[model samples]
Target: MLSVQLFHNFNKYARITEADFGLIEQVLSKKFVKKRRTLLSEGDKSRYIYFVEKGALRSFTVDKDGVEHVIQLAIEEHWIADLYSFVTKAAGNINIEAIEDSEVWLLPHHELELLYEQIPALERYFRQLFQRAYVSLQQRLNLTVSSNAEDRYRQLLQDFPQIAARIPLIYIASFLGITPESLSRIRKQLFQ
Candidate 1:
């Protein structure tokens, strides 16, 4: 059975009538991922977009130095994907993995294309998702370039309040482009 939350999320972007939504429910498959399991590895073809049904997942990249940079943290109701690879049919540089045991709904790209034509409203939902993802990318770029580490950390807390407690501190530090020790100091300063 499909989740009501997913249905609500879909309707949030575009209306899907009861009958039309059944078309969607038919195509999405569910997968349960264990903690630390990789969903999409770097250099793999991005074949699917996942909607988090329960628990957490993260998308990140490993640098030449072997340092990981967290790109996005996805929790319940969040959609995670390497859109660039998905759209271009190119190999993806991003890696996605479960941070905790998780249940996710998968929407395969090939199926999505057929759904777009069959359910025109689905296109608008995906379009808004991509637009939001792009805006988030642009905003993060602007914030990273113009802000200090402390400011960046502060903004992160403000934007994703659940992240600090739900995700590991190390990943948060990586996302902020700072050492874990630096994050500890920032937390101390903010709290005390």
Candidate 2:
């Protein structure tokens, strides 16, 4: 099942050969997380990068005043990790929490290095993944800086429609950089 999903994800960019699939199956471990559980917390070293097999997750951080700020949302087939900590082996500054009961396929950094060494194409595959992730972060930053709350909400819906149904209004608001009441008003305005 995971192999099929991986293949589908890579189909547009590159094909995953049987050997590559075998290696991934061997090295990657699948785990389940219940809603509201933390996959990684602030100050913890990120040890694995996760690919969502089912459900959703969110990455966020708390401000000095203890206000939570959402950074990114990951749905099915999406990847999540603190790239800075994952790559640098430093403590993560953010927290990744399960938004729903989720199944995640994890690839450890060490195993990933082995994959790169054993399968040359795996490096190219991850390079493309990093490129996409970078572009996504850039776009998110641009939206947060340039767009209004309503615009951000609409764009979030456009990008991930299922999120609106699965994530709480408060979380959606946080992710959009808006207050919960403001998001409530925006939702009413959207339908009208």
TM-score of candidate 2 against the unseen true structure: 0.94
Q: Rate the local accuracy (lDDT) of all candidates.
A: 0.92, 0.88
lDDT top scorer? 1
Q: How big is the positional error of residue 145 in model 1, measured in Å on the Cα after superposition?
A: 0.4
Candidate 2 CA-lDDT value:
0.88
Off by over 4 Å in 1: none
Clash pairs (backbone) in predicted model 1: none
Candidate 2 residues lying further than 4 Å off, grouped into runs, are 1-3
Per residue, candidate 2 scores C-alpha lDDT tens digits across 1-192 of 464776677555566787678877888888999999999999999999989989899999999999999988888888899988999999989899999999998899988988888887778888998998899889988998999889988988998899888899989999888899999999999998
After aligning candidate 1 to the native by TM-score, how far in Å is the CA of 152 from where it should be?
1.1
What is the Å distance of residue 145 in model 2 from its true position?
A: 1.8
User: Which residue pairs in model 2 clash with each other?
Assistant: none
Model 1's lDDT to the true fold?
A: 0.92
In candidate 2 the C-alpha lDDT for residue 33 amounts to: 99
